[model samples]
Target chain A: MLNLNNLLLQVIRLLLTFVIIFLTLIIFGVSPFDVFESILYGSLGSYSKFIRTLIVWTPLCLSALALIYTFSAGMWNIGIEGQIIMGAVGATFVARSFLGDDLISPYLQILMAMFFGGFWGLICAILKIKGKVHEIFSGLGLDFVASGIVIYLIIGPWKRAGIASTSGTDIFHKASWVPTVGDSNFPIFLIILVLFLYIFSLIIFRYTSLGIRLKATGINTFATNRFNFSSEKYIVFSFLIAGAIAGIAGFSQSSGAYHKLVPSVSGGFGFLSILIVLICSRNIYFTFIVSFLFAALIVGGSQLQIKLGLDHSLIGIIQATFVLSWLVLQKIEIEKITYKQISKMFAK
Target chain B: MILLENTLVTVISLSTPLIIAVIGETISEKGGVINLSAEGTIMICALFGFIGAYETDFAVVGFLCAMVLGAGISFFISYCDINLRMDQIAVGFVLTILCINLSNFLGQDYVRINGPLITKFSIPFLSDIPFFGSVLFNHSLITYLSIVLIPLSWLFLNKTSYGLAIRASGENPSSASSRGINVKRMRLLSCVMGGSLLGLAGASFSLYTKYGWSEGHTTNYGWIVLAIVIFGGWNPFRAAVGAYSFGLLQVLAIKAQSVTLALSQILPLLPFPLMIFILIFIQYINRDEIKNVPKWIVAILGGNQPQSLGKKLPEEIK
Candidate 1:
């Protein structure tokens, strides 16, 4: 019965979302058909656009997967943004340490990125476990501090010489750049790495004792104690894993796409991944499709700017409306159940 | 003497928005709802308020528009959390991102554009009172109103029957409902009231304090306001003090930058980490294992959050 209600809610949410998007397009004085055509052309029409979608899809997929662990553990890892930033910072630090030397492998830099990102996540975990600070506040505080650190680096010490541009550090040596497919910057290796991690996580989540323990811990921390499983250890481990994956997502953004660090390297991917996770509602298969669609929306949003003179951020409105309406519909379903129950009681 | 007076003035002006925001949050939390969309709400409100004032050439109209938007957004958050049984934090976090993106998208044209500003008004008698006059009397009407709100909020939370109901709802909603307080309604009202104040704070930024609309305008102030609420132990007076001190720190960070070039860049970053440290420090001191601490020290440092905060009231109550 609950499954049926959820399915009904999902269908209603999809219809309402379309209606909202259609109305929004009308309000902007743009034809829905034209915008849809442009979006289709921009996201999947040509080879270059398809690759661009994949470039966005890679990190978004990784970040969404990273969030799965934390969300499964009943944690709000809102600090994923900070972890991603720190990961980029870590990778940059390693790349810059070579001082333009061509000896250090880019692979090593990615590893360092994961380490630093995981360390940052561990710090948030420690705050929760020891300091009793809520992860949400602690994570938020860290995000601000991390961004401040990045801005300070770009403008102060690590700034490009002579002009102090917010353009970020000089591009890492070509050796530091992740290898791409022929004639295209498509990060084939990173894509494979992300896919491997995704498959590995899927298997672990389904078949392993660790996954069961984590799920049990999340569902009832007290019950986990009764079962003699240390929920804290699982929680911390989940954060560490999530942070590392998110770190690699950050590394992918810098090394794979931009070839250098910028202040906005994460490109709000951390938050976008959260939306994807919520929309998927813990279904792994759904996560893959949603991440791809979200990536298309983002890529296509930029097209709206070029083709229709509409702000790309129109995508934000659509996405927000989707999540908000989905939530509202879920609430309505619950209200219906309760209303029916009350009416039955009155009749009796 | 001159430098101290100047710094104090800056602090007072800077803290007004925070004061308003913290009071609103305090009220909302007192009624057992945590409006975590504060950061995004403030950003959106700042943008909308600026656009309204810019279009209408009236700061008052901008503030009114902002309050309405804030209330509307708050209503949505409450409706989702209360009626839908959604996680308040999750819904709030999503709303924050949504509003932020919406503000950026919609306010693209308004960015860097000049807008109407609230004029500073000083009471004649108060303006001549030496130290107090310069420190307190020489500010705009909005700033004065925020100052007044500190005391008014405290009284409202502690004195009136409604205030008692709010506190009762936050502390023990089940009992409060049993006593016929209508906990859900109280929570809804508190959220709307708090959200309106947040809107006022956002307007204060574009219309008065920061005095401009730009992308990322009034950045991170919302988070700082949240920090101040925790630091203030969720009390209006204490939160106001925390906001003022934070403003002083920001001023000092700027001043220090002039004193030393290389270190100054890093100095501005100090407040965020320091706020986090303070949050942790408060928790540490408040631990049950701690002994030998003075009574007043414990009272001032420890924050006892509302017991029933973030929990959904049982539907059977209604």
Candidate 2:
């Protein structure tokens, strides 16, 4: 029954978002029918387009999965963006080294990316636990610093042949690149690896004692102490896991899609994943479906830029509308409860 | 002497918008609400303020429009926070991203377009006072208003009855409600007022300091303003000082570029990490676990954040 209600709520939120998007289209002087038709055709019209959608879907899905762990542990992890960047930086460092020696393995670079991303994530978690700083502020501050670090590297030390452009570092050698299927940008093995991880997470979330303890820590930190569970350890553990997953997402983007470390390599995928996770309400299955749809939105939104001269950022507006409306709907549901009932709920 | 005077003038001019923004955020936080949407709000307002002035050719109209937009966004945040009992941080974060993207999409046509700037007005007698005249007496009207806002906000927050109500609402809403203070309404009013000031700050950016709108313009300043509020301990006077100091650092970062080629680009990033360090340092010195810290050190370094700052008010109060 709860799942049914959640499904209903999701449908309502989706409808409201479409309505708002329609209105936005009108404001942009585009026809709703044409835009909708184009969006449908653009994202899934051909086999290649579907593959493109899946390519975008991969990183977004991973980021959402990462967020689920952090959100479950009651940490905002707003620095996921920074963690992703650090992952790219880690990967870039390895790839750049390979330029001098072509024999270095690609798998080691991916491992190093995860290490760097996890390290960055640990910094935010440690700041929260040890420094008594709020995760939101510390994470945000770290994000700026992380981006600054990237800019410094790209424009300062890592400039391609004494020419510093926003175009980013010199491309990695072909051997260092993630191998993709013939003429397709999708890395088939990496996609399978992520899918396996997603299944593993689902099992962990449903059947593992650690998952239960993490949820308990989120619900009531004091309750965990009574059960001899260290809430702080779980919090830190969740952040590390999330950061590793986000790091891999960053690695995939750098090695798979761009094949170079551009300043916008993350492309707001970190923030976009937060919206997807929120819409999914922390369910892994729901996250998989929603991520694909959002990926389609991104691909389709880019198509709008080509076909209708609309700004591609329209996708962000649409995503924001969906999340904002969902928040409002959740608020309306909460407002229906009486004060006495809420007090009783709190007491429990 | 001339270079120092010029640097001082630049610092004050650059600090105006930050001062106004920090004061605004301080007010809202004092009333128990956190507007994390300040970054997006500033960006959106800057774009709209530019568009309004460009079309109407009136800077005042542009400023007014920005304020109204700011207030409207704040009202939405307050509604979600107070009426729905939603998390303010989550709502504000979403709003921040939404407003930023919306502004970018809508402001594409207005980018790099020339518009009327806010006119600078020099004080009659103060303008003739040598170094001080050039440094302090000469600036846009918005800068003067920002300067006035420092003392005005301090007096209003400290001395007024409404100020007491705001503080009470933030500190202990349930008790404040029991005293017939109407905690929700006070928070709503404070949020709107604070949001208006944020709008003014945005307008000041476009009309006075930066003098035009562009993508990612006023991007990270909102987060800096947030840090400044905490650094100021939510005090208006101290917050203004924090803003001015940040402005000085920014000016120095630019000037330091000529001295070193490689570190210059990295120099500007120093304030962000420094702010984070300050946040941690303040918390470390204040934690009760650190018993070795002296009482006077605690008194000086420990910021007394409102007791129930982010708590949801009881449904009965609404």
Please give, for residues B163-236, the per-residue lDDT of candidate 2 as tens digits.
99998998889899999998989999989998988988888888778989888888778888887888777889
Candidates 1 onward: DockQ, in order: 0.59, 0.67
TM-score of chain A of each: 0.91, 0.90
| lDDT (10s digit) by residue, model 1, range A141-253 | 78778777787787777878676667788888887887778778777888889779988998989999998888887789899999988999988998899899989988888
Clashing pairs in 2: none
RMSD of each: 3.5, 4.7
**What CAPRI class is candidate 1?**
medium
Q: Candidate 2 at residue B69, lDDT?
A: 93
TM-score of chain B of each: 0.94, 0.93
Docking class of 2: medium
After TM-score superposition, the amount by which residue A151's alpha carbon in candidate 2 deviates from its true location, in angstroms, is 1.5
Score candidate 1 by TM-score against the native.
0.93
Candidate 2 chain A weakest ten by summed lDDT: A98-107
Candidate 1 residue spans exceeding 4 A from truth: A1-9, A99-104, A162-165, A334-348, B256-269
